[model samples]
Target: SQTIHQWPATLVQPVGSPLSLECTVEGTSNPNLYWYRQAAGRGLQLLFYSVGIGQISSEVPQNLSASRPQDRQFILSSKKLLLSDSGFYLCAWTENYEQYFGPGTRLTVT
Candidate 1:
């Protein structure tokens, strides 16, 4: 009965501005959370993953960071955005090694 939720659905921002995307999972305990990005014609790229509270693993080096503030909450943030940061952001939770994604957030940096 675990459900994942992501916010804003879509965003358009100027370069050098701040960015914050949130993800939360309900009806689960000690779940694994992940953040991914997808660009046009590109496969889903793993950005970050959390195995436990405050334990985050970065898969790619970029101008972004991830944090697990609560057991069921994960956040992706950028201090300053870049044009190259535009993409579809996805949040997912893992259960038994299978990841279920949220609706996703589309971000456009201009």
Candidate 2:
């Protein structure tokens, strides 16, 4: 069975601080990976996606960036977080056109 994992289930950081969140999948290979963000009570927004190692695509213009350094590892980073960056971040992978999501990370920027 495939499983997705995300670290730092919840976070609180001051504005302008650096941020790093990680996501990984097990039991899957070359899956279509994606990163998404959801603001409080808002719909999910696609942030980044990768089809292969070192390949990344941005869905929206923002202060965040994503990297896929391995087949099953994805990382999201921000040089300096903005107050508006606070939200729920989700990592997902697609299999047979169906998407599976991780537990997600909730970030609060102060």
Candidate 3:
């Protein structure tokens, strides 16, 4: 049984602050990892994805970046957060084209 974990289910950050969110998978190896952001009442937008360790592809170029340092560890980071960065951040893993999402982290920027 594969499962994904994401921390700090909700977050509040000021404008222009640093951001770091972590996600990990258990019971799976070399699974495709992805970071997606969902705006209020909108669908998810892919931020980044990784196929293997140290391999990442960015779907959007903004204040956010992603990295896969280990086969099962993925991280999303931002050096300077913006108000627009506030949203629901989700980490997911894919197997056979099906994706399983984490509980998500809601960020509120002010």
Best candidate per TM-score, number? 2
Q: Across residues 1-110, which tens digit of lDDT does each residue of candidate 3 receive?
A: 99999987999999999999999999999999999999999999999999999999999889998889899999999999999999999999999999999999999989
lDDT (10s digit) by residue, model 2, range 1-110: 99999998999999999999999999989989999999999999999999999999999999999999999999999999999999999999999889999999999999
Model 1 steric clash pairs: none
Q: Write the per-residue lDDT of candidate 1 for residues 17-55, one digit (tens) a residue.
A: 999999999999999999999997899999999999999
> Per-prediction count of colliding residue pairs?
0, 0, 0
Q: Give TM per candidate.
A: 0.98, 0.99, 0.97
The best candidate by lDDT is 2
Worst 10 residues of 1 by lDDT: 92-101
Runs of candidate 2 with Cα error greater than 4 angstroms are: none
Colliding pairs, model 2: none
In model 3, pairs of residues that clash are: none
Candidate 3 Cα outliers beyond 4 Å, as residue runs: none
